[model samples]
Structures are given as structure tokens and as C-alpha cells.
Target: MNSSEIIPSLEQSLITTDRDCIQLGSEEVATILVNLKSEEGEIIEEGGADVLIYAEGIEISETEDNKDGSYRAFISGAREINEARVGFRLDGKPSTKLITIRVQERCPEPFIDFERTQLIAEPPEILNDGKDYSTLLLQLYDREGRLLDDKTPVSLMANSGILSSTVFDAEQRLFTAFFRSRRVGEVGVYVSVRNVRYPVTIGEVRVVDPEPPEEEFSIIPYESHTMLQSSSLYLQAAGSPGIDSTKGIHLRWMLRGALGELHLPKGNLAEPNQTFNRSEDYVKIYRAKYSKVSFTLNLNRERPAVIDHANRLWIYRKEETREIYLYFRNAAKYDSLISNMSADINHSNFIALYHPELLEFECKDDLFLKLV
Candidate 1:
């Protein structure tokens, strides 16, 4: 075919629109439709043609294919006073015709989606350790249910806690921040949109001091021989603050065995007759004591070999005293460590003692028993 019969002229093509102009920040979007025709006024239905809508301060969706010779495009005014330029070109040809649409100035109706906008804490609660924290989330949207523009300024402030930052998420659709506190008090979080509107209260979170630990301790006999006064035992102790804490606490274990001289590690106590062990370190979040404590017991004499049933071991803690009797007669026959024993027995004339009951009730004991 000749060039005039093959190509369509831009002047002969028909351009139509649903509206002459679009109102900025309006919920209603504008649509534009274009139809191309050959020199003889015949509709050109050939595919692979270059058709596009270019605009400044406007958001455009992908051009929709009309199957016939016409195409449809959607445009939304993004700036108060801007314009959009619509054009089309056949394959391997430059754009021949251009259409301009005016954008009318308007104010957007912005509101917070209270259902979607929320403040959540990772742990729901925190300690005054200066290390624990909670995550803060906030989201804002316009009347059209679209996220506010990234350029929309925001202000986030915490009354009593530490705020990591007031920045938005990577996608710039949500605001994420971290809150922490070193003092025991309540934190009130507030947020502002565009820096001119009234602040929105996120909610309150509490920062509390670590709960004092309910310290527990006990003594257990590992092995013993009735013929010889020599015996071995394990001193186990454990306790933890309910929450995390930087200010460490103290746990002490003291002993008093009158029937025989104690043969064990040096004592930290002032009294010579009372040997003691102690732990003074901070406790981490959701964990037991900072250290595991277990000590061994052995009889010490100027000379070895002596049996006694009145042998006693005592524990001094929290200004309270507890005692246990160690018998040399049934040390081998009544193996307390192997049999079922009450865990709360602070005083017993036997060989071993376990607290909070035995973990391994069968022949296979726990690692703590194996270590003993």
C-alpha cells in the first residue's frame, strides 16, 4: 500500500475525554479515550502502537487496551495547580498530536483510619533496665483510603520513654518507631499529621522495676558409706528477678555442720564456722539467675575416719535460718538421691535432698544430678 494509505494522520484521529479538567486532591479521577483512523477515515486496528498519557503533578494508571482502534487512560490530579499532556504515536513514529488538561486547585480531606492505625508493643510490657523496649506503629490515610504521600510531614513524641525515631517504613506507607525507658513510670505516645493538625494520642505503656526474686536453695547428698564417716553432698541454689535488671541482686548460701568440720571451698562469710557462697550479677530478660550454683560437701578433720548421726548443715538467708541433719548410719542403705523425696524438706536426717521435686523420676537422672 502507498504511504498515505498505510499511516494515519494525527489531525484525522479523534480524541475524547469524560471531563475537561480534574480537581486536585479529589476522589474522582478523570478518563481520556483516543481513536486512530487512516487517511480514508477507516479505523486503524493494528496492534503494537505507541500510546501514552504524560502529565506533571498527576498520577496515571497503565493505559487500557480497547481491542478496537481506541485506548483508555485514567489520570488523577496530584498537585493543586498543574496540567496533564496526553499524546499517541504509531509504531516506529514520533508523537504527532498533544492534548492538555488543566488541574483545578483543591484541598484534600485527610483522616486517620483508626481501625488500621494502631500502636503495638513487641513484648506488651517492659522493664526499667534501659535495654528493654517496645515497637510503635502508626498509619495515616486520606478520604480515598490511600496512604498519605511520603512528603507528608509527621511528628511522633513519647512523654516518658525513649523514641528511636519518627521515620516512616521502607515503603513510606507506615510509621514504625521504638520506645524504651530507664525509669519506672508510664509513657504516653502522641503523633501529629502535617505538623499543623492536632496531635493524635497513640496510647500508654508502663515501665516497671524488676520484681524481687523468690530465692530458693537446698542441699543434696551425692554418696555416702556407713562404715566410714566420709560423705559427699551437693548444694544447689537458684532464683531470678521477674523482669530484667541492670542493678544486680545478691544470693548467698551459708552452712553450719557441728558434728564434723566442713571440708569445702573457702567461705565468703565473716564467721569461721560458717562457710558461704554468693552470686551478685544482673539478670537478663526472661531468664533464671545470672549464674548456676552447685557446691560439694566433704567432712574435714585433723584426722579422717569418724561416724556421727547428729551431723548438721544450716543455711542463713534473708535474715532467716534453716537446718538439715546428716546421718552416717543409713547413708548407703537409704540412698535419698535415688528414691522419691519431698522437694520442700529443708531439714532431713538423710543422705540427699532435692527441691521442686526430681526432674528424672526413673533411673535416668537429669544433667544436674549427673554433674553431682
Candidate 2:
């Protein structure tokens, strides 16, 4: 009979048995018989072909050629599998059609593989102590519960900190990269994988100051005069600066012996004259010494006033009334928002009487959340 016809005949009349001629049980040892063939409808002779078998969870014990265009194989396994295949090569040519088999039998345990494997960081947050770094662990897995051998390079980047190495050897997936703090902001670490279009942020680190002390300084009034006088008033920094880039001290300008309190819209140290711009729609200054002016230094908004200073005043009668605006700004003098009101001392629609207004605002450094 031809190879195709012989295979079907042998399969129909095949007998299954163990070494003791007993029927095989579920997940137990089994001996199977397979007919070998060539592509030209000819039977493969003994020692004329090399056979191969592929089973996901099964182990092959042994195989023997029957010398009559047939082969026998012994295999044992306890894992449930859906499909298996048998292949052979004859006359220096591999078989195009492989023998497929169904291995649907009761298994002791089911096999599973990881999906969308990822690399992760242990203890995602770390102190900026400059000595210890986070450990990067590879979570890749296979159905066999073995570590997959991979050699692809992984790329790394940081927004604000320093990384010891940028390229990682994926084969030795478990590794540690040293990190150094460069500034007082949040640090983010990113990783790029092969075939991935965008990089992923894996972890973050926060660098903080170790219990900063309270700021000590004084606000020096260089020049002072009444609203009627053309002479200008200026406040300068006398000692070490009281504010940093991330925070600022509050300076409350007050007025006594006046119909309404004085409002210094811009108490800028660099340009004291801009604080008294009279043409602006906002009330830069209130009615003269008849409207008096003073200032109170506040190191902390939660605490009481630290220092207070007042300027001597005289009355002045002006032609028209000017507007006043309460301007909000950050430590870097960035204009945030402004509120306008009529400068009329009687009405004082928007101006609060002797109320503490904030001129220099505190804000967080933008570099903290910046992406590389």
C-alpha cells in the first residue's frame, strides 16, 4: 500500500498498551506507534529517516524504528496539552506535512505563561541619600516556569537625577543602577523597550531638604515720604535674603491717621518706584499722610508679625483720584493675577481696611514633575 493509505490502515488497527499490556490511564505512560513516509507516496525504510517530536509538557522516554516503515515512541507527562506534532526527514528533505495529534487527557496541573511581561522596580521610592539605589527586577516568564533567555538592550532615562548606566543588558535582567540627586525636586525614571513606540515611567524619587531652619533678616526702608511729597520711598534687603526660589516671606503694608489704609500694589525690591505707579487703574498709594503709610514684615503666615515699620506723613490735595489693584506674584516676580478697585478713600469698594494682603506668593519648583 502507498504511504498515505498505510498510515490510515495502521492507525485504525493500532493497539494501545503499557509495558504490562494494560490500557494507559490519564496522564500515565503511553506507547504510541507511528508510520513513517516520504513526500513521493513511498514508505521510509529503516535507518532512512530521522524523527522528531514536539510536546509542550510531555517528556519523551525512548523511540525505536520497526524497520518496516513504522516507528514506536514512549512518552510520559502530567501536564494538559491541546496539540502535539511528529516530524521526520528522509533523503535530505524534510517532510512538508507533519503528523498532528490531540493530547486531550486529564492532567494533574494546568500550565500557564505570562502575558505582556514587564520590568519593575523594587521599593519604588528612595531617599536622596546618594548611596543606595533601587533594584530593577525583570518579571519575564515562560510556560515552563523557567527564566526566558533574552539579550535585547533596555534604555533608561531620568528627568532630574543622575543614572549610573543608561543601557542595560536584558540577559542579566536583575541589576542595580546608582542614582545621584541633582536638585530639590521629584525624580522620575523611564524605560524604553524594543518595538515600543513610547517610553514608560517606572518609578519616582523625592529629594527633600533635611529640616530647614527658620529664615532671619530685616526689611530696611532706604527712602520714605508722604503721598504729597515728590520724594520716593524704597525698602531694601539689609541682611541675608529672607526668601528662596520655592518660598517667599510676606510683607504687609499698613496705614494709620488716614481715611483709608495705604496699598502698595508692588513692593518690589529691584524697582521701588514701580510700586508707586500713580497712572495705573489700581490704587498704588492711598490719600497722603492725612493718609499715613506703614509696613509689617511677616516671616511666616501661620505665625504672628515679626517686625513693623511706619512712615511719617503730611496731607496733600490732588486733582483726580487714581485706581488701585492688588497684584499677586510668585517669588520670581511672575505676574499671576490682579484685582482692581476705586481709590476713593470714602467708598474704598475693593480695598480691605488694614487687612493683610499677599504680595509675594510661594510656589513649587516646576522641575519636580518635568519629563526628560
Candidate 3:
């Protein structure tokens, strides 16, 4: 036969050995069979031909010749889904008998769990004055009891009040709805997702009279005591005036000793204790001696006059009466050294030395002195 006649005489047919469609997530095999024939309808049994299969124009499988004029290729549905086209070639010829295979989702329906849904109205009540607002949180779950990941459209309807705005957070898988009402009554809310409507009774919000604000008070001690020359004093005050609290009462303490005038905020006074330290010359002499220390606790907001005294000494005495003596050597060096000390009184009243000779000091909750 001439080359033209021989090429035209060779024919190929492709057929699927399995179903035309595959179900997703199912481990089913799809097989294609290729047959080669002569013009006189005789099977070409002598094999050595290449056949390939493609899905969505991407090659997925290649055929193995059976040495009997028939070749086969297979694909697993579990690994691939969607529509695929199958084509076969014989002896380097162009592909023919192209067929399409389909892959479909196995589940026929999508559902959600209504019983697991949640609706919460923050503050539960809003003032009837119209300016105050309240927020509502809505949590939704799928039938598998998992948070819905997709942005499913949801609608909200109120029986009496109006929903001002709504926001959905995909990361938290919840929706926040802001609403307000000027009338004093109960506002019922209904929700709908994916065309499924829920009853208004799911969540109820109340609009009522605004309650009066309550008074609050607190006394916070200065974090640390400042050590100037020899005096260690800490300052404590009633609630942060004007900054944190609208109303605050200031207190002061009067010290009657060589340490000079020490102003302290009123709280409580624990007995002073003494300690001996031989490591530093500044505190070595006063070891184990109680320097005359006395204070009258008074609550008054009068700003004390700045007193600058020389050759004065101050001591910090804890509840156990452990004394930490501080004395000044050089103004610059003493200020630098004491600035690194800090103390925390744990909500207890502390006395701070306010002297022109001493700089500022702070104390932390855990009683430790660091100069700042």
C-alpha cells in the first residue's frame, strides 16, 4: 500500500470502560479503551503504539498497549474532579474520537443547624433618649456543627425597632448588628440566612430609662520612695484627680522629726522598723537605730510648701518594720543612684519625702526602691 493509502486506511476508536461520570470524593477508577483497525476491519495485533488521556486539556494518563490492537488508560476520581476530555492517538497520528467525562459533587444538599444558632444583645437594654446604642451578636453553624466559612448572605428584620448597621467578621465567624430605639419597649429581632427565615422571638432587646452613674473612689500610692540625702519618703494620693476620676479627696501626712516635713496621703500607718547595714558608709552609722519618726495622718487637699532642708535623713519602714535607710552623698551621684530603686506597696499607704534637697522618686507594687 502507498504511504497515503496506508495512513488513511489506519483507523482508531476510543471507548470508556467505566461510567461516563464520576462522583467526587469517591475512589472510583475511570478507564478508557483504544482500538486500532485496518481499512478492511482487521485488528492490528502487533502493538507498539502510544496513547494518552487528557482531562480539561491537561494530560492525566497514558495507555499501555495490550499487544492485541487494544490499549487502556485509567484515572482515579478521588484525585481529580470536574469535566475532562479523553483523546487517543495511534502510531504518532493526531488524536481522534475525543470524548468528555464529568465529575460531580456526591452530596446533593447543603444544610445548617438552627438549634445551634446563637443571638446575643449586648447591654440588653438601651436608653430611650435615642443617643445610646446597643449591639447584637449572631453566631451561625453548619449542619456539621462547624462555623460557616463562606460569606453566606444573611438578612435581619426587627418587629419594632430598626437595625442601624451590621458587620460580619469571617475570622470570628460571627455577625455584629448595631441598633437603637427611642421608644421604651421591647424590640424583637428575626434573622434569615440563605433564604431561610428565623422567628423574631429568637432575640429580644429592651429600651428603658437610663440609670444614674455610680460614684467610685480609689487610693493609689506612689510606686516608689525618693531618697534625698538620708530621707526616703513615698507619696500616695486619692484617685487620680480629674485624670481618671471626676472627684478625688487628697490627704497629707505631717512628720515631726529631723527628717523634716514629710507630707503623706491618708490611709493607714504601720509601725516603723529598723535595719543595720555595714556594707555602705552612708547607712553604716545608723544601723539598728530608730531615727525619731512620727507622723499625723490628715486628709486635706492643701498643697504643702516646698521645704528644702540640709543634713536630713529619711527611712522607709515596712509592715514588718524593716528599715531601708537612704542618705545623700553627692547631689548628682545620689540622684543617679536612687533613681534606679523602685518599690511596690501592694495598695498600702506610703509616705514620700518632699524636699527641695531631694529629687522625685517612684515605688512599684512589690516594695523595691529604684530611682527614676
- The number of the candidate with the highest TM-score is 1
Q: What's each prediction's TM-score?
A: 0.31, 0.22, 0.28
Q: What does each candidate score in C-alpha RMSD?
A: 23.1, 25.9, 28.9
- Where model 2 places Cα greater than 4 Å from the true spot, the runs are 1-123, 127-132, 138-150, 166-175, 194-197, 213-372
- Candidate 3, 255: how far from true, in Å? 48
In model 2, the clashing pairs are: 282-323, 282-324, 282-325, 283-323, 283-324, 288-291
- Taking all chains together, the TM-score of candidate 3 against the true structure is 0.28
State the local distance difference test value for candidate 1: 0.50
What's the lDDT for all of these models?
A: 0.50, 0.37, 0.50
Which scores higher on TM-score, 2 or 3? 3
Encode model 3's per-residue lDDT on 228-274: one tens digit a residue: 32223224444555454446544333332322232222223322321
lDDT of 2 by residue, 1-372 (tens): 322243222111111212211123445554554444333222233342344333333455555766555556765553554454444333334445333334553322322133434546555555555444555554444467654334533334354443544344465744345455525567666543321112245556666543422211122233322333222333232223654323443333333221122334442333433223233424353433334333332222222111111111111112223211223223122211112322232222222322344342211211111111
Of models 1 and 3, which has the larger TM-score?
1
* Model 2 TM-score relative to the real fold: 0.22
lDDT of 1 at 273: 30
Worst 10 residues of 2 by lDDT: 305-314
